[model samples]
Target chain A: MKKNASLTRLFWTSFSISALTFGGGYVIVSLLRKQFVDKHGWMTDDEMLDILAISQSCPGVIAVNATFMAGYRLRGAAGAAAAVIGCIIPPFGIIFGLSFFYTAVKDSPAVRGVFRGLLAGVAAVIADVVVTMTTPVIKAKKVLPIVIMFAAFVANFVFNWNPAFIILFTAALGIALQLARFFRRKMAQGTGDR
Target chain B: MKYLELFWAFFKVGLMSFGGGYAAMPLVQTQIVEELGWINMTDFTDMLAISQMTPGPISINLSTFVGARMGNLLGATAAMLGCIVPSCVIMLILTRLYRKFRTLETVQCVLAVLKPATLSMIAASGGSLFLLSVFGGEPRDLWLAGFDWRAGFDWFAAVIFAVGLVLLRIKRVKVPPVLIMLGAGVLGLVFSVLPAVNG
Candidate 1:
């Protein structure tokens, strides 16, 4: 529908973008902004960010979902196919190639040493992530969310409950809270009208 | 049979993954590592670390890595296919219902709750990996399972984690994870030579 670019070009654009970026998700989103907004002039920066928000909110790999949406926006289903295929090929190929060597070296003592170190390093990074994630909750100073956060952690870590259930349960509770708040406000407004 | 099982497990991972790449970690731990027993915790975490250095989404990289580990090229293909199908389908459904989908109050509410919830998931996964890597046991096992205390701890790993934490926690510098990991690996190599502990 938009037709700013051909299918092949879209495919290649996605492929090159997917291939080049190291850290996925946010990194890809930034590149998308540059490509679609800066290079091709296909969409405004704000428009691209809106697509990104939807892509992130949806349940999937951000890259695939974004490309699907972007491609659909551009040229419909066929465009989506081309773009996704391009985006997928590089990661699949790169990982597939690395898997062989990793399998061979994995059990070696030296590799084991590296693995241990990598684990600690990853833990540290996740720790940093923990700070990043919790700061907003701390700032909000809402007791319910703080309680929900700890409860979710306990359910998974202590009880060994599946993270999926935790997500679903918390979402349900959150929605209930939102509804209750909505009703409270509505009742308040009704009383004011009287 | 094996390929089908692998595909199904990853499919659920793709479906339940709410937030993004890191959010999928706990799902992978539950599905592939714990349920299916395709790989152990060490391999899972190790592969995750390697994927951090690679150029791809963590889910896809993990699916391909785990699949290739379980079966082969065809198996990897199947697992990947399973993973992507749900994502594509869900997105397609949203695309069709695009007008009303984004504005849905429930969607916003769920996401609001999930933001912190998923972060806890990441923290929990990180804690488990931290346990296995340094302490050689989970909190439950180390505490309730009568696991030996002194024998379970790894000093070098703890030190590496401590140092890396200090370095990584400094948010303004924007240090790359791979750099700290590689440096820690070298430090680990230095400790590996010690007679008693592998570190």
Candidate 2:
């Protein structure tokens, strides 16, 4: 009974966060961190960080991915569904409405001004996210990640290279590094046993 | 013929775009401009600008605009739906599977690698967009003397950006993004109505 209740709470919390947040996946991160990690003590900082990492690698929306992991952690399959629904419902509703009235609302001078202001804010949010995400990269002092970031930036900005290539290349790079590390550990262990 | 192709192409782009709409841009550009020949480079750029100025995700907005251009309202709907379906279905399935393997170390490590890559992709995309915002043909070509500092400054945007930065940095204030967007719209309206001054 206690577990079920907790799962219910997780569902509502996830739903509320997704429903209310406006700027999409990036903005949702801070909110999720606050609610799940700080406010509820549902997940630790390390756990939240781990979830974020997993969400990035997977093939779906980060928010949905994070919610799935979080929900599953708390309450299994049912919990995951609740969280996913929570994350998606708001965006779906908002998008549907926007789609309906988009043509009419788009041309209003007031609306234009708001978007202008919002764009700046969105830029600010993106900057904040970049800073947050870069911390680990700096700590790890992984030259490859930095190089990849810079190269990708240059390629996309200057040459207009496709991002799909960038993502695929980096994913492959990551997998190769992991395999190398695994083999190195195994070799070291074998030598010690001798 | 073209519209159906656009729908399928964008659907593929949408499915492959894991992070979000922005992440989908490079793929969309590659398919539409480089591969399909549906839209030229200049038009694609314009579509991007228009998407930015409008509400909704960049991917959806572009799909709608491009779809409309290709085959009217139905095409727009199809493209938009195509872009969204992949993420939606994927999310649904992942949500179901998430309960079983949420805590594995190997899973954790993979995620660690992906996080940086995702960040890098977003940052790269942002840099690209910044270039377009500043150096795109429209801004450069619109200049009266081919170089007017005041008009080129985009003072309104800059001021809002600066003010927002200060508010965000110092106060730790959490202002709703929608409010800021609305404020900019009002500012634009005011600027638009103001009489032009000849230097």
Top-lDDT candidate index: 1
Cα lDDT tens digits for candidate 1, B30-94 = 88888778798778888898877788677788888888888889888878877777778887887
Q: How many pairs of residues collide in each model?
A: 0, 8
- What is residue B62's positional error in candidate 1, in angstroms? 0.5
lDDT of 2 by residue, A1-194 (tens): 22333666877887788666655565666788898877777767877886776565556455666777777777777887777666655544444444455546655655454444444544444445466567778788887667766776666555656667766776677678788888888999989963
Docking class of 2: acceptable
TM-score of 2: 0.67
For all candidates in order, state the fraction of native interface contacts they contain: 0.72, 0.29
lDDT for position B94 in model 1: 78
Instruction: Place model 1 in a CAPRI quality band.
Output: medium
Q: Any runs in candidate 1 off by more than 4 Å, and if so which?
A: A1-4, A178-194, B189-199
Candidate lDDT (C-alpha), each: 0.82, 0.61
Pairs of colliding residues, candidate 1: none
